[model samples]
Target: MSNRGETVNIAIFTNSYLPFSGGVPTSIKTFKNAAEKLGHTVIVFAPSYPGHKSNGKGVIRIPSVKAMTYAGFYLPVPFSTEITKAFRRYDFDIVHVQHPYLLGETGMKMARKYNIPLVFTYHTMYEQYLHYLPVAESIANPVMRKFTTSFCNHSDLVIAPSEHVKEFLSKRNIETSIKVVPTGIELRPYRKKFRKGSIKRKHRIPQASKLLIYAGRITPEKNLKFLVKCMAKIAKKDPDVMCMLIGKSAEKDHYEYDLKDIVKREGMEDRIMFIGDVPHDKLIDYYKEADLFLFASKTETQGLVILEAMAAGTPVIAVDAPAISEFINGKNGFTVPQNMLKFTAKALSMLRDKKRMKQMSSNALKTAKKHSAENMAKKLIAEFRKVKPTQDEYENMRSLKDLSEIDWSDVIKKIMR
Candidate 1:
């Protein structure tokens, strides 16, 4: 593990990438860009999107079809002769896979063929995402767990973005080396100079309104319906308090319409605003402009947005979930159960107290400083150095002819179906 200053090449495979914003894409881009700044070469292999340009940036987009159920997500035709050729040319030192399906399996095969270390990041709790599948939960739950266990065991090392994910894997009895490394953001971006009322003025948010921002995907697993109900109750007490739901839905989730319906039914549409997706570069201003960050997702590995919000000196009011338990200490933020009354009471109390919110905001900045992107990149690079493949092992691996003989056309066709 002695490649501190030496240059190394890393090949990353994922089902999603930029033009699509989320924790997975943001985490990969942050670490990849940070590693590159340290003189390492990183290449991303992701699914191609319709009417979107890669514009270079070391990304190789594979041919794919738009996932109708999960809007903005593409299902890639994994069998690509061109990708195989590119793999042979780049000669990456290691392969890092973001998800444990489709592109992940392909990455594993290529890693074995080249006799390189294969590392998998356990980003999502597959059980939580089973809602997206049309299959029955009784059947899909075990299948996903089995598949996840198999994928992690096959890897040289498993990277867990948080202790919560690590604990989830431990319970599954995965017999692989697991490391807990929290994904970080470029703190300076959130700390940069931005006009104080710019976001509110542009969005037509009233100056006297007490702004609360929720920045994440709008999906069922996020427990957003409950949030809408809570906001409706809170609105009756303080009409000046406004709640904004930021970011696009991970899919065109049915929950989105339901949330809107609840808002309309309760006559809280004026108080609650759905300000679609915000650009990543300009996201900081929203965080900085807001008084508090609202996160109710029970299914996050690390909740990168929480850290981003903290970096902007905004305190978070979230549910008592394992994913975000590590970040909150009561001083920095408040964690409550899923109960609407309890959560609303806490949110209202925090908003009413100016002194407490100021202290929490300062504490939030202190917590954010502890998780720097540069430090996270260095930790990943250290792990990469620990998995160097020997020359004889590389020689013993499969040849290009053997790789080509495997029929991936059928596999790609199946996924397309």
Candidate 2:
């Protein structure tokens, strides 16, 4: 623990970090920035990206190689002596890990060695992502579930991004204390004024076009094919409506090619535009410029992009899932089942109604205000304090023998089996 009053030293371990604009990286950056503003030290231990260099202040990059299965992601070489030496220097009060494998296992070992609390955030629905593996779904799904569940059970505390995610972990028989802490958004950027039609002008989209947008990684698990189908249906009714997808494919699964093929088959290439990976600051403006924010992902734990769109005073029309249902209601946005007919109908209805759209836009902004980054940081800090070790316990832990060497490959193989 830090000598400073009410402040604690935090060590965050994540497989992914900056230069990757996925939910896990975004969530880690959001919490780290907000927590630092509230007077705490956060050191991120993440995989090294190819050309990206860390400032080497709060962030520690580990040696890694590019993953063959997943694009724009690196697999950490977990047995680095430099990382071990650097980790021993910090008197971390609690260890927070964003994933349950690779770096996550290293975090668990470090926490055990130091006798600090191991806190795991249930970020992704891991089983849904088994398509990345070469193994069959039937074989991979059970292994993934077991691997993640065991990690959660070992952790002293587990953080779920939403109440629905908490329920999910509980059902998995995760025998650890779970807390709901949705990744917070910085509201200041959303409040700033930006010129209207700037995005349309830049993209050569017509100024009078009704813009619908989706932001996140273009991957298989995101259910982007359904979104393309919905856009095709909407285009038939409204000639002026255009859908802009603002993200790049972060996986080598060729899902982007599949989506483009569908768009071509439907003969709606002009109606749908793929605007890959907008910077976070600029993405807010894109969200604000859109008339509606469309999401079709069924596997999000707590769709952070949905909240971002809401922050920009844009109403969402998302496929109904546990996390999506919590935020998207009749007041702020509409939630529909996975049915394409129902989703397109809701989207078309919202676009045609001016008065109702205005009311929902106002409601969306109000909803976003309640989820400010500061509030979520405070909640996260509270959770850290709850699991922090006592002074005597900390002292005793330090006196204990050093952690033994581990064969990571063997451990991983055992877990997979």
Model 2, runs deviating above 4 Å: 1-5, 251-253, 388-417
User: Residue 206 in model 1: shift from native, Å?
Assistant: 1.7
In model 1, which regions exceed 4 Å deviation?
A: 250-253, 388-417
Q: On a 0 to 1 TM-score scale, where does candidate 1 land against the true structure?
A: 0.92
lDDT (10s digit) by residue, model 1, range 1-417: 336678888989998888788888899899988889898988988988888885368888888876655768777777788678878788688899998777887888788788788989999988988766655778778777777786787788899999989988998878879999888777767756799989889878788888888988888888898888888887788888888898788654466778889999999888899889888888888899899888888888988999999999999889889978888889989889999999999999999999999999999998988888888998888888887543433334343223432243543444356
For 133-159, candidate 2 gives per-residue lDDT tens digits of 656789768767777777787778899
Clashes of each: 0, 0
